[model samples]
Target chain A: MRIKELFINNFRNYKSLHIKPKENLNIFIGDNAQGKTNILEAICFLLQGRSFRTSHEKEIINFDSEQSKLKTELKAYNQNYSIDISLSRTKPKIIKINNSTTSKPELATNFGTIVFTPDQLSIIKGSPKERRRFLDLELASFYPQYKYYFVNYQKVLLQRNNLLKELKEKKQADTFDLLELWDNQLISYGAKILMARMEILKKLIPMAQQIHNQITSDKEKLTIRYRSSLNLNSNFREELIYDQFREVILKNRQQDYLKGQTTVGPHRDDLVFLINNKNITDFGSQGQQRTIILTLKFAIINLWSCELNDVPVLLLDDVFFELDSKRQKYIFDLLNKDVQVFITSTGMANTEKNLINIKKNAIFNVRSGLVCEEEL
Target chain B: MRIKELFINNFRNYKSLHIKPKENLNIFIGDNAQGKTNILEAICFLLQGRSFRTSHEKEIINFDSEQSKLKTELKAYNQNYSIDISLSRTKPKIIKINNSTTSKPELATNFGTIVFTPDQLSIIKGSPKERRRFLDLELASFYPQYKYYFVNYQKVLLQRNNLLKELKEKKQADTFDLLELWDNQLISYGAKILMARMEILKKLIPMAQQIHNQITSDKEKLTIRYRSSLNLNSNFREELIYDQFREVILKNRQQDYLKGQTTVGPHRDDLVFLINNKNITDFGSQGQQRTIILTLKFAIINLWSCELNDVPVLLLDDVFFELDSKRQKYIFDLLNKDVQVFITSTGMANTEKNLINIKKNAIFNVRSGLVCEEEL
Candidate 1:
C-alpha cells in the first residue's frame, strides 16, 4: 500500500497543505511543534476515519475554521483509491471513499495502517486499559468483524453496568431477570471478542518472539499472553468460553450489583509481555521494553504481509532518533522493498544517514504550518 | 561530586565487579540485559540505600548468591566519603557511612545523586501516584527532614484508613473520636508535605521553563503546577494550608467511611505539566513529552547547584540515543565541567560521536556482568 498524494485544509496546524509523497520513503523533518506530527496524523485520519492524536474531533479542526478537510490518493493491491474526510465542530464526520459515502469501519477495511509513536510506550508502562486498547485496535485493524463484536460488547457492558447501578439505587431484587438478559448479550459478544483475541495472539506471539530474537541477537526470549477476566483453561472453543463467561457472570452478579458495575468481560482483559519468564513491565529495563514494542510492531507488519498478501502503510513518528543505527538498519531490512514508509524527525539525528535506499526517499521541510518538498 | 571507586559483589548478573570511573564522563556500553543499568542502580543504592529499579531488595542479589554488597568512594563538597551497603534475601539492608552505621535518609543527605532512566518517563505519563512520588523523592533528596515528615504522613494515612475500615465494619459512631485523633496527625504531616512540595515547585517550575525554552529554541513554554487535594490559595503559610486540609478532610470523612479508604491528602496530590497552557500528557507529542522530562531533570540539576552549591552525580541510562545531537549538546553545555556523569548505552549509537569533551571521558565495555575500562 502507498499514498500517492495527500491534501489537507483547516486541520491542526496545517491551514492548507498538499504533496505527492515518494513511493517508498517520505521523510518530514523539522524542529519540535513545527507541524511535523500533524502530517502523520492527517494520513492516519484519512485511512482510519478518525484522528489518532485526540479523541475529541473538534480539536483537529483549525481554530479559525469550523471544519477540516482531508483527502488522500493511494494505491493498494495494485488498485487506486481516493479517500476524503471532513470534520466539523458540531456535526458528525462525513467520509467519502471514491465519491461514495462510507462508514468508518468500511473505510478501515479498505485500507490498513500501522502507526508507532512515542506515546505508545504506554502499552508497557501504562495501565491495563492501555494493553486492552492495543489488543482491540490491532484486532480491529486486521479483522473488521472484530470491531463489530468489540463495539457490541462495550455497549452491552455499559448497559449492564447502568442496570446494576439502577438496581443498587432502588434496592430492587426483581431486576435480576433483566440483568440476566444483558449478561447473555454480554457473554455472546464477549466470547467472540475473546476468541478473536486469542486466535490473533496465537499467531502474533510467535512472530513477536522470532523478531525479538533477531533484534536482540537471541540474548533474551519474548513471550506475550492473554489474561482474560474469565477462567480460561486452554480452551479455544467458543461454547466453552461462553459457558465459562456465563458461570463467572452468574457468580459475580452480587458483587457487581454491590459495586454498581460490570466486573467480568473482554473489557477487563489485559496483555502481559514477558522476557525469559520475567514480566517486562515490572522487571525489564527501559531498553528491553522498547525492544519488545518494536518487535511487536514489526511482527504485526510481517503478519499483515503474509496473511493479507499486502502490507499496511507504515507511520514512524519521531521514533528513529530513539533507536540506534543498528536497530534502525534492522528495521529498514525488515521492510519489503515496496512498503511505503512515512517518518517524522527533528532532522538533526543520523536517521537520514541510515536510509537503506536514499534514491527512493522524498524529503520535506515543515515550519509554522507550511510545508515545502526539498530536492533529494 | 565524583565517584573514585565502585565495588560490587553478587549484584544482579554481576558476580563481582569494580572500577575507578573518570571525573567528568563515564560511559558504559553494552547490549540489552547485559548489566549496564545494574551499574547505575548500584550507585543509586549506595547513595539512597534502596534499589531504584525494584521494591524487592532480593531481586538485586545474584541468583547464585544469597546477598549483595556495594561500596563507593566519592568526593562531594570538598569532603571525601565512603559508603557501603549490603543486601540479603532473608534480612534487612545494612548501610554504613564512613565505617559508621547510618540510616537511608541520613545517607541520602550525605551524598546527592540524580538518576535519569527511561522508566522515569512514568513521572509524566503515569498515574497521579507517580507524580506524587516525583515530588516526594526530590524533596526527600534535598531535605532529609522532608523524609521524616513523609514517612510519618504515610504512617498516619495508613492508620487512618485502617480505622475508617474498622469503623465501617463495626458500625460504630463512637470511634469517630479515635478517627479524629488520626485525622489531626494526618493534617499535621500532610500540611508540611504540601508546603515542602509547593516550595520546591516554586523554584523548579521557573528553571524548567527557562531550560525548556533553551532546548526548544524558545518555541514552547513549560509550566508545572501542583494540584493538591486541598483547596489552597496563594498563601504559603503552613497554618493556612493546615486549615484548608482540616476542612477538606472533615468533609471527606463520611465518604471515606463509606468507601473504607482515605480520599483527601498529600497522597492524592498530582503534578501537571503544561506546554503553552496545554496539558502535555494529553496534547503534546511524544517528542514534546520527552523534551519536557529532560527539561525537568536539567532544572533539578540547576536547583541543586544554586541552592546546595554542589551538583549531584549524574546518571543517565540509555536516554542519549533518544535525543538528537542538538538537544544532547544543550544538555552537555548545561553541565558544569567539574560534574561527574555516568551514562549507559548500547555502544552502537552515535552517542560516542557527540561527546563534547573527549579527553575527560572514560569508556567501559560491559557484557555478561563484566566491565572493562578503555583508555580514551
Candidate 2:
C-alpha cells in the first residue's frame, strides 16, 4: 500500500507538520540528525502502531509536549483509509482507525507495512534468537492463525516451565498429571507451529536458491536446514511426541528440579545455515555471510510478492551510500520500473541520478525537525 | 520511507516475483496464510539486512531450494537506491547495496527503516527483558556509537560472569584486580547507556502523558519511570558506582560463588510503567495495559523522530483489526495525511472510506503462496 498524506503533531521535532507524498517516489534529504528519518518513522509508526527505533512510546513526543499524535491517509486497492494514534504521558496511548478505537489484532488486520533498516544484518551475525524472531513475525503477520498458535505455544511453554519449577520445589509425584495436561496442550500448539514452520521453509528454499545465484553470480550455493531435537522423519503425532520425550523428561527430572527450568521441546529447536555443505557460521567469510543474508531477503521479497500479489513499499534509509556503484546500479535499474519509494539520505548528493530522472518524484529537504518540499 | 519497486526470487513462496508499488498507497490483501505479510517482511529484510519475520536467513529460502534473493529498487530522498540480499540453505545470508557487496554496518547506514507490529504490545505486557530489548534496539539503530558501547558492555558482563563462575568452582579468593578492571569497563559503558536512556526517557515522559491523556480522554495519565539498582539518583560517576556496590559485591562474593553468576549492576535494572500514579503491571485492566503499550509505541516513534531527525518506516501487521472502531478511526484519520503507508488486511470492508477512495493505490490478492493483483 502507498501513503497519500501524513500529519504529525508534537511528534519529534515537528511541532505541527503535514506532507503529501508523491505517487511514485518521495525523498527526504537532510544533514545528520535532521528530521529526515523522523518523517519515515512516522509513517512506519502509523502502519505498525510502534516505532522502528525505540520501544517506549513516550519518546516520540516533542520534548516540551506531554503527548504526540500521528495521522495518515492511505490509498490502497482503490480505497482510502485513515489511522490515528495519540501518545500520552500519564496513561495508555490510544489508537483509532477511521474514528473507532481498536485492539492490536484488529489494528493489524487493517494496516500492513514492511520496513528495511540497517540493523537487519544481525540476522546473519547475531544469535539464533534473532533469526527465530524473524520467522515468527513474518508468519504472524501473514497468518493470523500463526499468531494465535504462536502466542498459545508461548503461553503453554511458560506455564509448563512454571509447573516444572513447582513440581521440583514441592517434590511431588502427582504433579505428573498436571504436567501431562500441559504437555498435551504444548504439543497441540507446538506441533502445529512446527509443522507450519517446516512447511514455510519447504516453500521458501528453492526461491532463495535462485536469488542467491543471481546475487553471487553463481559463485556459491547456499542451503538452509531446520534442525529439531524431535525427528521430523517420523510420524509427528501428539502421542509420538509425548512418547519420545517421556523417558528424557523422567530422566531429567532431577536436573529440572535443580535448575528450576524446562529443558526440552521446540524452544530448543534451531535452524542451521550451510554453505557448500559446511556450516556458514563456522566457516564463511564476512562478505560471503553478508551475501547469504542479502539473497535470503530478496528471496523473501519474491516469495511475499508471489504469495501476497502486491509489491510492498520499500523504505531505504541511508543504505545507498554504503554500496558500490555496480550493485547500486542494479538496484536502481530494477526499481526504476514501477514502485513507490521513500528514501532518507544524509544529503541528496549521496544518491544516484536515475532517481531524480523519475517522472513522478518528490524531494523534500529536512532540517532539524522540519521538512519542506524542494524543486527538482 | 516508501518502496518504489520490489523483485523477489525463491525467498518464501515466490519462485520469481516482480511488482511496482503505487506512489502513494499499496495494499496486500488476502486470506490468512497467503503471504501478504511476507511481502512487507521481505522489504524489512532488505533494509535491515535481516527479516522481521524469521530469525534464520536459511529459513527464508524456499524449502526445495538452497538459497534466496531479495532485490528492491528504492527512490528515496530523490535518489535511486538498490538493495540485494542472498540467503542460502547451507551458508550465511549475504547483502549487497547497489550491487556492490557491503557489511552489516554499511547496509544499516544506507538503508534505515522503522517497523511496528502487534507483537510490540508485549513490550508493556511482557517481562522486563522484552522492554530492555526494545530500548536497546532503538538506541542501537539511531546511535551507532551505542551499538559499540552495548557490545563492549556485553563482553565485560560475560567475562565478569565467567570469572564469578570460575571463582566459585575453584573456591579461590575474589579476583579483585581483574574484577576492578571489568568493573571499570562495565561502569564506563553502562554509564553511557544509562545516561542516554535517561536523557531519552526525560523527553519521552511528557509526550507519553499527553498522548495517554488524549487516548483516555483525560481519564488517565501515563508515566514511565526508569527504576535502576545502580543508584541513578546520585552522581553516576564510576567512582560513586564502585563505592555503592563495593560492600555488596564483597559481602556477596561467596554467595555469588555458590550461585555462579553476577548478582548486581545495570544488567539487573528494570523499567517500570505507571498509569495514574499506579503501576500498570501490578494494577491495571487489560485494556489499560494495552493502551499503555500503544502510547509507548507512539512515544517511541516521536522519540526516534526527534532524536534521529528522521521518521522511520512504520510496519503495522494486523494491529488495526484488534481495536474498537473509535480507535481504528483515529488511526485511519491519522494515516490520511502524508506518511507513506503499507497495510495488509483480509478485506477492505473493515477499513475507512477515505483509505478506500484513493485511486493511486496498488492492491494485491494473496492465497496459498500465490499472489494476483486485484482488478480495480
Candidate 3:
C-alpha cells in the first residue's frame, strides 16, 4: 500500500495543505510543535476513521474553522482508491470512499496503517487496559468484522451493567430474565472477539519472539500470553469459548450483582509479556521494555503482509531517532519496495546519515502548518 | 549534590559493578537490553530509597543471587555522606545513611534526585493517576513531611472506605458513629494534602510556564491547574480547607452509602495541563505534549534548586536522543557546574557531537551486565 497524495483543510494547525509523498519513504522534518505530527495524525484519522491522539473529533478542526477535511489517494493491491473524511463540531463525521459514503470498518479494510508514536510506549509498561487496547487495534485493522463484534460486545456489556444496577436497587424478578438475554448476547459477541484475538495471538507471538531474538542477537526470548478471565483451553473454537464464557458469567453473577458491573468477559482480558520466563514489567530493564515494543512493531508488519498479501503503510512519529544504529538498520532493512512509510521527525540531521542508502525517498519541511517538499 | 562513587551488587543483570562518576556529567553507552539503565536505577534507588522502575524490590536482585545491595558516596551542602541499601527476597529493605539506620523520607530529604524516563511520557497523556503521581513524587522529594501526610491520607481513605462498606452491609448505629470518626480523620489528613498540593502548584506552575515559553520561543503559554474534589477558595489555610473537606464529606455521605465507597478526597484529585489556555491533553499535538513534559522537568529542576539552595542530581534514561538539537541545547544549558547528571544512551555517535562542548563529562561502555569507564 502507498499514499501518493494527501490533502488536508482546517485540520489540526493545517489550514490548507497538500503534498505528493514518495512511494517508499516520506519524511517530514521540523522543530517541535511545527505541525509535523499533525500531518501523521491526519493520515491516521483518514485511515482509521478516528484520530489517534484525541478522542474528541472536534478537536481536530482548526479553531477558526468549523470543520476539518482530509483526503488520501493511495494504491493498494494494485488498485487505486481515495478516502475522503470530513468532521464538524456539532455533526457526525462523514467518511466517503471513492466519493461515496462509507463506514469506519470499510475504510479501515480498504486502507491499513500501522502507527508508532512515543505515547504508545505504554503498551509495554502501562496497565492491562493499555495492553488490551494494543491487541484490539491490531485485530481490528486486519479483520473488519472484529470491530462490529467488539462494538456490540461493549454495548451489551453496558446494558447488562445498567440492568444489574437496576436489579440491585429494585429487586425485580422480571429483570433477571432480561439479564439472561443480555448475557447470551454478550457471550456470543465476546466469544467471537476472543476467538479472533486468540487466533491472532497464536500467529503474532511466534513472529514477535523471532524478531525479538534477531534484534537482541539471540540473547533473549520474548513471550506474549493471553490472560483471559476464563479458563481457556488449547481447543479455541467459538462454541467452546462461548460455553466457557457462559460458565464464568453464571459463576460470577452474585459478585457482579453486588458490584453492579460486569465482572468477567473479553472486557477484562489482558496480555502479559515475558522474557526468559520472567514477567518483563517486573523484571526487565527499561531498554528491554523498549526493545520488546520495537520488536512487536516488526512482527506486526511482517504478520500483516503475510496474512493479507499486501503491505500496510507504516507511520513513524519521532521514533526513528530514538532507536540505536543497529536497530535502525534492522528497521531500514525491512523497508523494502512494497512498504510505504511516512515518518515525522523534529530534525533530519540526526537520521540523514542513515538515509543515504535509500534510493526512493523525499523530505518535506513542515513549518507552522505550511508544508514544502524538498528535493533530495 | 554530586555522586562520587556508585557501587551495586546482584542488582538487575549486574552481579557487581562500580564506577567513579564525573562531577558534571556521566554517560553510559550501550546497545538495547544491556545494563546501562540498571546503573541509573541503582542510583535512583540509593537517592530515593526505592526503585523508580518497579514496585517489587525483590525483582532488583539478580536471578543468581538472593539479595541486591547498593552504595552511593556523595557530597551535598559541602558535606560528605554515604547511603547504603540492601534488599532481600523475604525481608524488608534496609536503609542506612552515613552508617546510621535511616528512613525513606529522611534519605530523600538529604539526597534529592530528578529522574526522566521515556515511560514518564504518561505524565502528559496516560491518566489522572500519572499526573497525580508526578506531583506527589516532586513534593515528597523536597518536603519529607509531605510523604507522611500522603501516607496518612491514603490510610485514612482506605479505612473510611472499609467503614462505608460495613455500613452498607450491616447498617449498625455503632458503625454509623465509627464512619463519622473515620470521616474526621479523613478530612484532617486530606486537607493537609490538598493544601500542600495547591501551594506547590502555585510555585511550580509559573516556573513551568516560563520554561515552556522559553522552550517554545514565546510561541506558547503553559498553565497548570489543580482540580481537587473540593471547591477550594484562594485562602488556602489548613483550617479553611479542612472545613470545606468536612462539609463535602457530610454532603456526600448519602451517595457514599449507596455506592459503598468514599466519594471525595485528595485521592481523587487531578492536575490539568494547558498550552495557551487550551487543555493540552485534549488539544495539544504529540510533540506539544512531549515538550510540555520536558518543560515540567526543567521547571522542577529549577524549582528544587531555588527552594533548597542546592541542586539535585539529574538522571536521564534513554531520553536525550528523543529530543532535537535545539531542545537538547536547552537541556545542556541547565547543566552547570553545580548540577551533577547521569545519562544512559544506546550509542555514542548519535549524541557525540552534542557532547563536544562539555569538558567535564565521562563516558562508560556497558555490555552484558559489565561496565567499563571510557575516556571522552
Candidate 4:
C-alpha cells in the first residue's frame, strides 16, 4: 500500500501543493513551520479523514481560507484508491472515496496508516488517556468495525453519565432502573471494543516482544499485558464479558451516580509493558520506553501485513532526527524497499548521510507554507 | 560545582547505596526501574533538598521504610559543600547545609543543576501549565526570592477568587470593596513574579536564538516572545506592570466571579517561539521544536555559567538516545570538560560510543533497586 500522489490546498500553512512522492522514502525537508508536517497531515487526512494535530477543523484551514481540501492517489492491494477530504470551518469534514461521498471514520477499515511522533515515544510514561488512545486508534485502523462499536460505547457512556449526574442533582435514591437501558447498550458496545482491543494486543505482543529482544540483544525480555477494568479472564465469549460488565456496572452504579461519572469501561483500560516481569512504566529508562514504543510501532506494521492483508504506509514525523542514527538504521532495516514511507525532517543532509540503505529518495524544500522539489 | 560523592537510602526504589562519582562524566547503565533515576534524584535531593520527580517527600521513601536520607559531598569554587536532606513519611523534608537546617527552597539559589529529559523536549508543545511550571522553576532556581513572591501571589489569588465567588453568591454589590485588600497583595506579588520571569526570558532569548541558529545551520532564526495576559510591552517597571495588572484584574473580576475561576495574571501566560516570525508552537516540525528545546536547555547552561559564577552539575536523564548520535555529538561539543555530567542509558556500548570526547568516565550497572559500579 502506497500513496502515489498527494494534493493539499489551504490546509494548514500550505496554500497549494501537488506532489508525486517517492515509492521508498519521501523526505520533506524544511525549517520549523514550513509545512513539512502538513504533507503528512494531508496524507493522514486522506487515510484517516482527520488531522491528528487537532480536533478543531477550523485550525486546519488556511488562515485566509474558509475551507481546505486534501486529495490523494494511492495503490493498495493491486488496486488504486483516490480519497478526498473537504474541510470547512463551520461544518464537519466531508470525505469521499472514488468520487462517492462517505463518512470520515469509515475510511479506517479500507485504508491503513501508521504514524509515529516523539509524543508517541513518551506515551508509555504519560497518563492513561494516552495509552487508551493508542489502543483505540490501532484497533480502529486494524478493524474498522471496532470504531463503530467504540464510538457507540462512548456515546452510551456519555449519556449514561449525564443521567447519573441528573440523578445526583435530584438526590434520587431509587433511580436504579433508569440506568438499565443505557447500561445494556453500553455493555453491548463496550464488550465488542474490549474483545477487539484484546485481540489486537494478542497479535501485537509477540511481535513487540521479538523486536524488543532484538533491540536489547536478548538481555531483557518484553511483555505487555492488557490491564482491563472488565477483568477479562481469557474468556472472550461476548456474552460472558457482557454479563460481567453488567454486574460490575450495577455494583458501581451507586458510587457512579454519587460522583456523576462513568466508573468502568474500555475508556479506563491500560496497556502495561513489562521487561522481564518488571513494569516499564514505573521502571523503564527513557531509552527503554522509547524502544518499547518502537517495538509496538513495528508490530503495527507487521500486524497490518499479516492479518489485514494490507501494508500500512508509514507517516513518520521526525523519525530521522528524533532517533539516534543506529536506531534510525534499525528502522530502515525493518522496512522493506516496497514500503512507502514519508518522513519529515528539518534538513535533508542528515537524512541522506544517515539513511544509507535508501536506494530511492525524494527531497523537497518547504518555506512559508510552500513546497518545492529538490534533487541531490 | 561537581558532586564528589552521593549517599542514597530508602529513596524511590533504592534501599542503601554509596557511590563515589567522577566529576566529568558518570554513566548509569540499567534496564528500566533499576534505580538509575533514583541516583540522579538523590543528587538533585542533595542540591535542592528535594526531589524533582515528586512533591510528596513520603513518596520518595521506600515502601517498607518510613524515612529516607540523601547526602552529597560537593566541591565548588575552592570550597566544599555538604548538603543533607531528611525525608520522612509523616513530615516535611528537612534540609541541612553544613549541619544548619534551612528551608528546602532556599537551596535553589546557591545550588545549580540543569536537567534534560525526553519529557522536556516536548514541553513547549504541551499545555500552558507545563510552560508555566517551567518558568516558575527556572525563576525559582535563578532567583529563589521569586518563589517566595509567586507562592504569595497564588495564595492571594485563591483568596481573591474565593471572595469574588462569595460576592456573586450573595448578590452584594457593596462587597466589591472587600476585594481591595486581597487585590493589593495579588498585584504586589504578581508583579514581582511577572518581572522576574521577564528578566530570565530576556536573558534566555539571545542565547537560545544563537544556539538555535547554530543547530539549524543558520537556515532558521529563532526568537522567543513572552506572551502575557497583561499585554506587557517591554516595560520592566514593577509599579507600572502592577498597576496594569490590577486594572485588568478589576475589569475581569465580574466575568471571573461568574465563572468561579481566575481569568488573568501569570496563570494564563505563555512563551511563544517564532522561527523567522513564524509561530513555532503551531508551525515547528517535531525536529525543529526539539532543537528549540535543546537550544533553550543549553542556553540555561550558559546562563548559569555566566550569572551564578557556578557551572551546574548536568543531570541528563537519557538525552543521549532521545537525541540522535549526530545531535549528541553537537551537544558533547557544546559542553566543556569542567562541568560534571551524569547520564543514564540502558546499555554501556551506546554511551561509550556516542560520547566520544570524554577522557574519563564511570559506568554503573543498576538492577533490582541496587547500583554496582563497573569498569568501562
Candidate 5:
C-alpha cells in the first residue's frame, strides 16, 4: 500500500499543510525541531488511528487550538482510497473512509504500513514485553482475527482480575465458583492465544535462522522458543480444553487476594531467547542480543511477506548511521527494487547513494512545524 | 538515516536472506505466519542494540540453533558504516561498529529511530502506564541524557523500594537513616526527571493541541496535565530534598511496613489527559481515545524533531486500514516528501497510487518463509 497525498490542519506545528507524494521515493529533510518527524507522524496517525510518538491525543492539536484534522489519499492494489480523522476536545475522534464511517477492523482491511525508528532498536536490547508487542502486532496485521482474540483475551483478563478484586473485598465463599467461571473463560481464550503464539513461533524459527545466516555470513545459528506457564503435556488439546487444577487454583486464591491481582496464566508466560541451549537474556552480550533481534525482525518480514503474498513498506529512521558498512550493505541490498521505503534524516547529504537515487522521489523541507516541498 | 544494505543468517526463519533496496520504496509482503515483521525488527536491533519486540535476546535466535549473527552496511550523511552483531548461547550479544566495539550510548548517538505499530492504538485505549511509556520513549530518543536519568532514577527507585522492604521486615529504627539516604538520591534524580518531563510537556502541549484540532475536525480541544504525587510548591522543590522529607517519610513508615513496598513518589505519578475540561479516559469514546493517542504521537515527533535537530523515521505496522478514508488521506498528506517511508500490506489490491508511484519502489512476494521479488 502507498500513500498519495496528505493534508494536515492544526496538527502539531503545522497550522495548515498539504503535500502530494512522489510515486517512488519521498524524503523529508530538515534541521531539528522543524516538524520533519511530525509529517511522518501525521501519516502514521491517518494510517493507524494512532501515533508513533506520544500516547496523548491532545498533544497533536496546537496549544491554543481545540481540535486537529488530518486527511490522506492512498492507492493500494489498484484502488484509490481516502481517510479522514478529526481530533476533538469533547467527543471521540471521527474517522471516515472513502467518505463513509468505518471501524478499525474495516480500516485494517484497506491500508497497511510498516514503520521503523531508533526506539525499535530496543527490540534487541530492551525487555521481553517489547518483543511480545512486535509479535502480537505482526500477528494482528496478518490475522485480523488475532486482533479480536487479543482484545477479547485482554478484556477477559481484566474482567477476571476485577472479579478477583471484588471477591477479595467481599471475602465471599462463592469466590471460588465465580473464579472458576472466569477461569474457564480465561483458559478458553488464553489457550487460543497460547496456541496462536506457539504456532507463529514455530513457523518463525526456521525463517529467522535463514535470515540470520545471511546477515552473519554463515557464522552462527539462531533460535526462538516459546515458554509458557502452562505445562504442555498429556493430551495437548484435551488438557487445554478439559483439564482443571482445582487444587492449584484454590491454593493461589489467597495469594491473589493479598496481592490484589491474579499472578498466573498466559499473562505471565514469556518467550525465552536461547542460543545453542543458553538463554540470551541471562548471558548474551550486547552485540549478540542485537544480532538476535535483527534476525528476528528480518524473520518476521520474510514470514509476513510469505504469508500475505506481498511486500510490506519499510521505514528506517536514523538507524542507517548506527550500522557499520557490512551490516549496512546487507540492509541496503534488501531494499532491492521492490519495497517502498521511507527514511528520515537531518540532511539530504546524510542519505546513502541508493537512498538518494530516487529520480521520481519527492523531497520536502520541514522547518519549525512547517513542511514545504523541495526540488531534488 | 537510510539503510543501504542488510544481511541475515540463522536469526529466526531465514537460513540465509539477502536483499538490495530501492532508494525509495521497498515493500515486503507475505502470508500469515510468515516473517515479514521480523525483517524490520532486525534493523531495529542493529539500531538500538536491542529488540523492539521482546525482552529476551536468546528468543531471537532461531529455535534449535546455538547463535545468530547480523551484519548491515549503512550509508548516512554520505558516509559508509557497518554494524555487526553476534548472539551466542553462553554470552551477551556482541556489537561491533565498523569492527570496533562500542557502548549503547555511543550506538544510540549514531543510530536513532522512531517506530510505530498498530498495537500503539492501545496507547489510546490502554492504561496510563502505556501513555507514560510513550512519553518516556520519546524523551529517550530526543534526549539521550534522559535515558541515563531514567536508568539512574529507576535504580534509585529500586534501591529505595528495597530499603522500604527491609524496613518493613526488620522494623529497625537505624534503617531510617539508610532510607533517608536513598530518598535523598531519589529526590535529586527524581527532580531532574520531573523537570525534564515537565519541560517536554510544556513544549509539547501546544503542538498536540494543534494536531488534535486537525484530527478532530476542530470539534474538540485537548490538554495534557502532569499529575505528580508530590506537592511541589515553589519551596517544596528545595525543601523536600530527601533530607527534608525525613519526618514525613518517618510518619509513613508504618504504612510502608504494612504495604511492604514504597507507596509514594513520581514513580507512581500519572499523566492526565483532558478534553474540554473532561478526562478522556473516563468519558471519551473509542474513536476519541484513539485520536488523542494519535495526537500525542504527532506531538512527540514534532517535539523530538525540534529538540534533536533531526526527523526520526516513522514506523507504522498495519495501522492504516484502522482509520477512515478522510483520516487516511490526512496521514497520506502528512508524510513530508523528504521523509523515507516503509509500509506493509496483506496485498497490493488495497494500496494507494502515491505509494505505488515512488520511483525506485520494489515489491517482494513473501510466502511461508520465502521472499521473492515482485516485478513492478
Candidate 6:
C-alpha cells in the first residue's frame, strides 16, 4: 500500500499543505519545529484514521480553527482508493473511503501501514501497556475484528476499574455481585484478545528470531515471550483461559478492593525479551534492545504482508537519524521493493545519497508548516 | 571532574571489568547486552551510590553472586578522590569516599556527574512523576539539603493520600480532624518543594531558551512553564503557599473523597513546553521535542557547573546514536574542554573519526560482559 498524494488543511501546525510522495521512498527534511513530523502525522492519520500523538481528536485542529480536513489517494491490493476525513471540535470525525462512509477498522483492513518513530522504542523500553498494544496492533492488522474486541476489552476494563473505585468508597457488601457482571463482560472480550495475541506471537517468533540473528550476525539469539497474567503453561483455549482469568481475579479481590483498581488481567500483561536465554531488560545493552525492537517491526511487516496481498506502507518518523549507519543500511536492505516508506528527519543530506539508488527518491524540505518538494 | 579509572565486580551482566578512561572523550563501543551500559551504571553507582535503572540494589548483583562492587578514582575540586561501593543481597549498599565512609548525598556534592541516556527522554514525554523527578534531581544537586526536604514531602504526601483513602472507605466524621494533622505536614513539606522547583525553573529557562535557539539556528523559540497544582502567581513563602494549598485541598475535598486519592499537590504537576508561544506538546514536531529535551540537558549541565567549580563528568549511555550529526556536533561543541565525556554506542567507526578530531580519544570494545581498550 502506498499513499500517492495527501492534502491537509488546519491540521496541527499546517494551515494548508499538499504533498505527492514517491512509490519507493519519500523523505521530509527540515530544521527542528519546522514541521517535518507533521507530514508523517498526516500520513499516519490518513492510514489509521487517528493520530497516535494524542487521544483528543479536537487537539488536531489548527489554532482558531473549528475543524480540520485530510484527504489521501492511495493504491493497495492492486486497486486505487481515496479517503476523506474531517476532524471537528463540535462533532464526531467524518470518514469516507471511496466516496462512501466507512468504519476505521474496515478502512484499515483494506489499506494499512507499519510505523516506527523514535518514540516507538517504548515498546521495548516502556510500560506493559505499550507492550500489549504492540502485540494487539500486530494482531489487529491480520484480524481487523481483533481490534474491535481489543478496544471493547479496554473500555470494559476502564468501566470495571471505575466501578471498583466507587464501590470501595461506598463500602457496599454486595459489590461483588456488580463486579461479577463487569468480570463476565471483561472476560468475553479479553479472551478474544488473548487468543489472537497468542496465535500471532506463535507466527511471529521464528521470523523475528531469524531477523534478529541476521542483525547480530548470529552472535546473540533473540526471543520474545508473551507474559500473560493468567500464567498459563499451555497454549490458549477460550474456555480454559476464561476460567483461569476468573479464578485469578477472585484470588486478587481483596488486594483489588484495597487499591480500588483491577489488580490482574490482560491489562497487566507484558512482553519479555530474551537473548541467548537471558532477559533483555535485566541484561541487554541499548544496541540489543533497539535490535530486538527492530526485529519486532520486521516481524510485524512480514506478518501484515502475509495477511494482505498488498505490502503495507512503512512510516519512519524521526527514527532514521537515530540508527547507526550499519543498522540504517540493514533497514534499507530489509525493506521489500514493493513497500513504500515515508521518513522524517531534521537533516538527511548524508543519508539521501545512500537511499533509493542514490537518485530515484522524493525529497521534501519542510519549513514553517509548509512543504516543498526538491528536484531530483 | 574526570574519572581516572573504574572497577566493577558482579554488577548486572558483568562478572568483573576494569577501565582506564581518557580525560577528553571515552567511547564504549559494543553490540547490545554486551555490558556497555553496565559500565555507565557502575560509574553512576560509584558516584551516586545507587542504580538509576532500579531502586532494588540486589537486582544489580550479577546472577548467582552474593554482591556487586563498583570503585572509581576521580578528580574534583582540585583534589583526587577514590570512591567504593558494594551492594549485597541482604544488606544496604555501603559507600566509602577517599577511604572514609560518606553519605551518598554528601559525596555527590563533592564528586558528581551528569548523565544522559535514551531512557531519560521520559523527562519531556513521560508521566508527571518523571517530570517531578527531573525537577527534584536538579534541585537536589545544588542544594543537597533539598533532598531531605523532598523526601519528607514525599513521605507526607503518601501518608496524606493513604489517609484520604482510609477516610473515604471508613466514612467517619472524626476522620476530618485527623486529616487536618496530615494536611499540615503535607503543606509544610509541599511548600518547600513547590518553592524550590519554581526557583530552579527561573534559573533554567533562559539557558534552555538560548540553547534551543542555537540548535534551531533561530528558526524557532522555546519556553518552559512549570505548571504546579498550586497554581501560584509569585515566588513562594512557606506560610503563604501553605495557606493557599490548605484552601485548595479543602475545596477539592469532596472530589478527593470520591477518588480516594489526593488530587492536589506537586505529585500532579507537569512542565509545559512552548515553541513560538504555541504549546509544544500540541504543536512541536519530533525534532522539536527532542531538541527541547536536549536543551534541558544542556541547561542542567550549565546550572550544575555554575553551582560547583568542578566541571561534571558526562555519561552518555547509548544516546549519541539517537542524535543527528547536527545535534551530536552541538553537544560536543557545547561541552567545556575540562569536562570528561563517556559515550556508549553499538557502532561508532564512522562517528569516532569525526568526533575524536581523527586523534587522541579512548575507545573500548565490550563483548559478553567484558571490556577491552582498543589500540588507536
Highest-DockQ candidate: 3
Candidate 3: segments with Cα more than 4 A from true spot: A152-190, A229-231, A238-268, A348-352, B155-187, B228-231, B239-265, B348-359
DockQ of each: 0.28, 0.02, 0.49, 0.24, 0.03, 0.43
Cα distance off (Å), candidate 5, residue B244: 8.8
lDDT at A371 for candidate 4?
79
DockQ order of candidates, top first: 3, 6, 1, 4, 5, 2
Tens-place lDDT per residue, model 6, A1-376, is 8787899999887999888787677888776666677777778788888777778788789887999999999887778899999998898888899999988777767677777876777787778888887877777778868878987988998998898888887887465878888888898888777777777888899889988877677878787888877876475688878888888888887788779998888788899988889877765666666777778877777777786666777888766645555566666667635568888875654554456553446888887887898776
The number of residue pairs in model 1 that clash at the backbone is 0
lDDT of 5 by residue, A44-72 (tens): 77877887767878877876689999998
Q: Which digits, one per residue and each the tens of the lDDT, describe model 5 over residues B247-342?
A: 445567667656876666657667888887767664443345656766776677677567665554445544443343445455555554434445
Worst ten in a row by lDDT for model 4 chain A: A349-358
Where's the lowest-lDDT run of ten residues in candidate 2 chain B? Answer: B348-357
Candidates 2 and 3, the one with greater TM-score: 3
| Model 6 lDDT at residue A334 | 72
For model 5, what is the alpha-carbon lDDT of residue A320? 40
- Ten-residue segment with the worst summed lDDT in candidate 4 chain B? B349-358
Q: Which ten residues in a row have the lowest lDDT in candidate 3 chain A?
A: A349-358
Estimate how well candidate 1 is docked, as a DockQ score.
Answer: 0.28
